[model samples]
Target chain A: MYWNEKHECIPREELEELQLQRLKETVERCYFNVPHYRKVMQELQLEPEDIQSLDDLKKLPFTTKQDLRDNYPYGMFAVPLSEVVRIHSSSGTTGKPTVVGYTRGDITTWSELMARSLVCGGAGRDDVIHNAYGYGLFTGGLGVHYGAERLGASVIPISGGNTKRQIMIMKDYGSTILTCTPSYALYIAEVINELGMKPEDLKLKVGIFGAEPWSENMRKEIEEKLGISAIDIYGLSEIIGPGVAVECQDKSGLHIWEDHFLPEIIDPETGETLPPGEEGELVITSLTKEALPVLRYRTRDIARLITEPCPCGRTAYKVTRIGGRTDDMLIIRGVNVFPSQIEHVLLETGYAEPHYQLIVDRKGTMDTLTVMVEVSENVFSDEVRKLEQLEYTIKNELETTLGISVGVKLVEPKTIARSEGKAKRVIDNRKA
Target chain B: MLKQLSVFLENKTGRLTAVTEILAEYNINIRALSLADTSDFGILRLIVNEPKKAYEILKKDGFTVRITDVIGVEMPDRPGGLNGVLQVMKSEGINIEYLYAFLGTNGRGAVVIFRVENMEKAMEILQEKGIQVLSPAEL
Candidate 1:
């Protein structure tokens, strides 16, 4: 199952050396070409030469989602626009998108790494990859597409949605691997049963699911429902799409492709790197990307890195699957929706109290986003028709702003729980 | 008009019994009780001897309690007696959100507690039509 053991299974010392070399080169690239990175580096009086070893990585300034947002479309690209062969972004409803540009060589590197990731997930040239990640601007579809193609696996380039069609194609083609969000995979399994088709009718062996945070119970649910090994894959458009790390057949933790993306866990509040195995926010540095190589980019995904040797034999570290985020960002149906975004909409509508809670739950196979808000005592005491009309107006305004339909629960004042310091704004029952 | 106590309880075993236990401890006689439920929670509406006292006790016990205004309509023990009040309500466009009944005190007749869109108007109309409308004192 090892596609490129030369890089995937590099010895620890050699891997660190390779990471340091690539880190140094990427630092120089970012510090010279991109003004944002250059300004950030010069602010600390830190030069590329200072990062002679990987330990000096802490000296470099940490780039954040705000940094990517501040430098909107092409400001973060290290290479010139002509050098960028493709661009991908995963934008929220309100603000600027987190953009990633890829050079031709960068695409080749991504495909190679994605191929390695697929091999780790027990997929190979003989397996047919049902690439269900979205295509075009969103990175998942094309990322897995090119990666499966590079692995010499026959790829059914079927993008997300169209559940019945996907099942039909999968059965007709005898596709051996399914690729999409974990929730969508469950929805597909549900559809198979609705069509009176059993899991045995389809020849699915492995699933490469990512683009959202999923739980172990969800993994088991998918495995049992689809009669396949559900492997977790992790990636974001800000770094490279769908193949930065993946769970091997051992099903322990995600084996991060450390040769390309150097992973770190840092205290989100103090900006201090925690010891390995301690739960903290994950930060990644793009080591080999040519077009938009990032330095210590704060991923905001909370996880622990396991450096202990794994049965999979990949010396690269694995990150424990993330269960929560450091920020109040809620990913609803693959779209990132912040509580502040909903709050902003509520405030702009001029109809609700500042207090609100985002209740996220799994309604069957789909994620249900229910925004709970408390109204003024006067508003609640009003006639039922007025309250219903106000709820309608608030739902409409929120849908307009957040670009997603949400169940609006209007309660009386002082109903939503308040806090002393940080307000607990999101209650995600999906993990429970 | 009779004051009905509505208590919010989580949908779990022994929760309803716990509420009943609280009522029993306070020696509150439950005249009529109805339970409305959803998946996560349930609303228990009770017309007791002293709704104000029952509401205070439930509120002290950390239950979300609301004292609502409802009129008790005395129905003839016969089957059409219940339909008579409903027909009047339907003609007057008085929407009944919910209704519950209990045997009349002293074995006079059955009494139906009605939560209507306009409680005052329904009471006036029922009394004008020679229908018996029980007051809080009577209950």
Candidate 2:
């Protein structure tokens, strides 16, 4: 099915006019339907008539993850519960889950966006798409599933786990477009090797990896191993799940659906807007969301905006690589350690797989960070002492490089946990 | 030839005793041991009766220890003896961070455990000076 393009390539003035009109309608709907939005809007003294133009969007109160938690389940829904067709929730590690409601129309819009993302990344109508994303309250699985189906591609609803089965179906179905996180894509390649199968024997062509921040080093690794073009897709559950933006063939940055969502880069510390090409936190406001319209939502993800029209012919604003979350930065003995920084060091080492975990603990009041990484078979040796020495050497190298001491724990191949959805790679146990 | 076993220890009182106890359990004798302490931690370097075996025993007892092949020069245990080695190293562009000599040998010779910043360059310097550099087997 063809998606609407009236919002896609419209002129700036026309798009802003449409956004202002939708902003007024969304404000009135929220004020009449959702009590939480009413309270926040009332606190800001913002009436539907006050938002006469797109510039007035700044007057709306910023919504946060905490706001979603305060208004759990259906508290943020702008429509009745009976009208909602599907629901998705966050990881819920912090507290009660931040639930998202999708009406039938919302689901259709979501599917259209995902289809656009897949097509933009070079998926064909006849190609079979393998959906390895999980299929529950998580949006990665079903989001891609419906998108592929809507695009008329044969859908393999293989939800996570069972690497052997995944490979079997991938080969049997002649899948051309693969959708999964980059780490899981690597794990699949490993299983293919263990089963004495060559990656070139598979008919896969493209990969959409997202839900967690991955390095370009990993993208090249995945592409070389699986013989497929890898693309980084960006989305969060608060913003109607994973199809919000996707990378085109140019592999520069993800092309966001600016017609439906307005993208802005803000200084994470000051909440002030920064120009394009400057690194800052991303704040999105969904202009056309019907059931759950979010205004000035703080994503907390660190990245920059690219307003330059991409060489791939898409006029949508692009977001560069997301650095990391602000609050998740770990301070180890006065040394700040972000997982991406550790990933950067590991990628620079070029010895281990992309799969890794950071273990942090306090040793006599001093923080010590230990990296658990898989020893690639290319560098594997049977001598345990030699391996131990290699670990020590790597630890010393990382210590010298990052200017902070780190211990390296080399594990047997495939020991670290793999996820079909967002990969969890960091574990910090320091109380401070 | 002499070998040195470097044991990592926290700057606590009984930590060294625990390491020594592990060595004693394995019946390993400490020929020459030097303790270098910083404000945070300490490195206990020992010239053991059996360097390899002592390192293994300590490692098995959960002590972080490493064995390195070090050159044990036969010096006269006098001030000029160390100066002679330093003059050769300095002329050969070798920088020694830390070094220690074993005592109680009746001033026969100084078995020095010296660490050069660059091992290959230091080995080249010693080779050029015709000094005896011991390997792990020689140690």
Candidate 3:
């Protein structure tokens, strides 16, 4: 049930010592090689030696996604191009794609971490992993591929799309493990239902889902529909991709690999680190990355860190599932709202489908939020008043939860565009 | 009591046409229909010859369709015809949620569909008042 037990379940003091050592080495590498780090360090009048303990980690400059974009192609890479054996870039749908490189040693470390992640999610060498995360450029597919290979498991690199064939192969090949985004997994379940097939027809036993923030309700839905234990795996392309942390079978929270990546929660507005168990922006520092050494990289993801020991017995501290991205946060008439909060409300209603889009428009000086949710069979009624009541109920629940009265629009089924990758849940027309 | 098919539709052009086209393709005749709409969405209530079949076809075509029991009563097909029925329901304090009317042939007179708060109470009152309530076969 455990992979790399020494590092995964290391004693608290021993793990801290290992983290400090690796942190020091990574800082020295960044200072000597990456000019961006050196310039920022000199501006703070700080040196690598100043990072004597993990507490000094706060002194290091925070790196943003813009910083990586400012560095462009390979500027943030600490090692030379020859040393970097592999390169990966984000989808860059927002702006410029942030590129990351990996040295051979970094690849090995990533593979080992992924191996640990797979085991943590209940996959073993005997499991056949059907990796549906896109392969090219995106780190999801290949990151999982290397890890499953490293775990000595059979991997079907059947990247995303062609879902019907993917399901066919899953059944034909007897794939025991599935790895993809949470939304994509639900789409697969829908397709299975459409094809008149049941989850029991497949041999899938475990699924590792990530790359987007999903609610616990989604986990239950996937578990029931797919007949598999859905495990949440957290990572970003900036860090080592897809294997930074993973939920053990305990399903409480994801265990961060403290030996390789140090995790912290910081107040997003103040940029000051928050105490454990407080919700804020998650900041991570890659302790052992060789090609690209990131120091206190601001993840922009909203989550809390739990220092309490998990029932799974992994000594590495756990991070609660990501709440939402700071960038995805919407300011409506001075009230902060996250789409996930709306999604949670909709899912909890049991009358609405998971497909919903948040549309924010500016009416003169006031910002208006209209939540368009697909009308499911359960909510539709022959009586207009009853249907209107369903809408009013959803609106009231949303207003109570979000503290801002919102317009609830009942859209027809399949009105929301379904994405095979990340689900696009928000459309902010107010942004100019 | 007759089964009426109700579909949730977005208030957009061609949505009504789309529903009708699907029903027409299945050779299902819409005897009487009423569209109730708001700025964002609409619910199309239909009294079709084959309510069960129409509901299945529309539902399989990805429409949010529902079937509900509604009363169909024969009217005089003249001025103030619906008023007389409403007056009868008013006397009994029976509230009508919604209603639509259509002409009937073969001397069956005009038929008015009634969706009321209490279907059985309205039916008993209408029957006792000597107003002819048409069944699905009569319609």
Candidate 4:
């Protein structure tokens, strides 16, 4: 059940050789075309020729989300705009977004990689892929769409929302594979029960879920409710969308496609690369990207790399399901939301520095973000309408900025606990 | 016009009790009270005998409290007595934000507290309409 068996099952030595060659070429492209990479390399007194072996990747300066943002909308693109056929953007910490471009060749490579991921997750040409990931500026929807088409499978491209219609299509169209976030899968399962339709009525067999961190208990729940094999896939827009890695039928760990991307684990605090099987921040280097070839991009996602060969016979190394993030970024319904973003909205409301706390919880199948702001003397009003208006204003501003709906509550003054050091800002009740 | 102490309270057990306990400790008698609430939190509006002392004590206890000026009118305790005051305000085009009733200290009729948008206009209209408007001294 492998797609591109040659690359998936490449020998360890041969894979290393391919990775090294691609890494050098990518570095050269970045240095010659992208000024940010060139400037950083020059500052470090390093050149493209300095990267002789895979270990030399450490010598290269690490790219960060801030670096990409500093470059802005098109500065990070190694290729010209005419060569970049498609563009996608992910949520950034501040107001600006992290934009990614894909050249025609890059699109083809992404399709092939995603094809490999879908096949690894037990999707085939005969399977009908019901892709529920979003389809706009976000990468998940079209990423899976192109790959499903490349796999020669029937893709529904339903995107997200309209759950009842999706379920109807899943049953009527006889969709065999479900692609969405793991929490969404559970939600669909709940909808199935509420409609009095059993899982057997649907033709679903395999589910590939990603875009948010989910627990193993959730996997078990989805499997039991939907009666399908739940596989965890990992990827980020900065690292070429959803096909960076995926779990095979083995269900142990996601096999990183070492042919196109080189993955590394590093100590998040010290920036030193950690040994294999050691848990730290996962840094990725795009080995074959034409539009944006990132050099050791700090993902801010904490994970470990497993070099042991999987039972599925893929020689590519596997990474455990992402454990946590090195920062306080919350993925609410697949949208990245930072506490600082909410604070910016609150502060921009023209009030004095207000005490605020973010309460993240899973309400049913959806992730809910509730912003608890203390009702300070400056903002307090005797009129209930005025107070309610303040709450509405905060909610509207937060929704406008974060691009997500949030529950805003005006609690009593000093109700939010104050810490002596680094004040606690978020209370996430979602299970790890 | 009468001073009313309004305190923000979260919808949790012991929160309302905590406010009451603090008020009792400070010897501030709640002459008239009304609690407006939503799902998340509540606003406890109170007409106390000593509003300034109550507001200070509640502020010291970390309660988001505000002192608001409201019109306290003495109305008949009989049915439709509230309609009389409402009819006058409706005719005069004065907006009442919220209103609540409590027994008057004389124990003869009910005293209705009205939180209006324009306190001066509401007081002038009520007095011209021959309504008994109780002031802070009377409360």
* Candidate 2, A199-276: lDDT as tens digits: 888999999888766677777878888898999998888898888988888888888888778888888888888888
Best by TM-score: 4
For model 4, how does the per-residue alpha-carbon lDDT over B57-124 read when each residue is reduced to its tens digit? 88998998888888899999999999998999999999889999988866768999998889998898
Model 2 error, position A115 (Å) = 0.6
Which of the two candidates, 1 or 2, achieves a greater DockQ against the reference?
1
Task: Determine which window of 10 residues in candidate 2 chain B has minimal summed lDDT.
Answer: B130-139
> In candidate 1, how many Å is residue A221 off?
1.8
- For A1-432, candidate 4 gives per-residue lDDT tens digits of 888989889999999999999999999999999999899899999998999999999998899998888989999999899998999999866688899999999999999999999999999999999999999999999999999999999999999998999999999999999999998899999999999999999999999999999989989999999999999999999989999999999899999999998999999999999999999999999999999889999999989999887899999999999999998888888889999888888888867886899999998888899999998887888777888899999999999888888999988877788788455799999963
Error of 4 at A344 (Å): 2.3
Candidate number with the higher TM-score (1 or 4): 4
Best by DockQ: 4
Off by over 4 Å in 4: B75-84, B106-110, B129-132
Docking class of 2: incorrect
Clashes of each: 0, 0, 0, 0
Q: How well is candidate 4 docked (DockQ)?
A: 0.69
After superposition, the stretches of candidate 2 with alpha carbons farther than 4 Å from their true spots are A1-7, A329-432, B1-139
In angstroms and one decimal each, the interface RMSD of every candidate reads 5.8, 10.9, 0.8, 1.0
Which ranges in model 1 have alpha carbons more than 4 Å from their true place?
A: A377-386, A400-403, A421-423, B1-139
TM-score per prediction, in order, is 0.75, 0.61, 0.61, 0.94
lDDT digits (tens) for residues A32-117 of candidate 3: 99999999999999999999999999999999988998999899999889898999986442335679999999999999999999
What lDDT score belongs to each candidate, Candidate 1 first? 0.86, 0.75, 0.88, 0.91
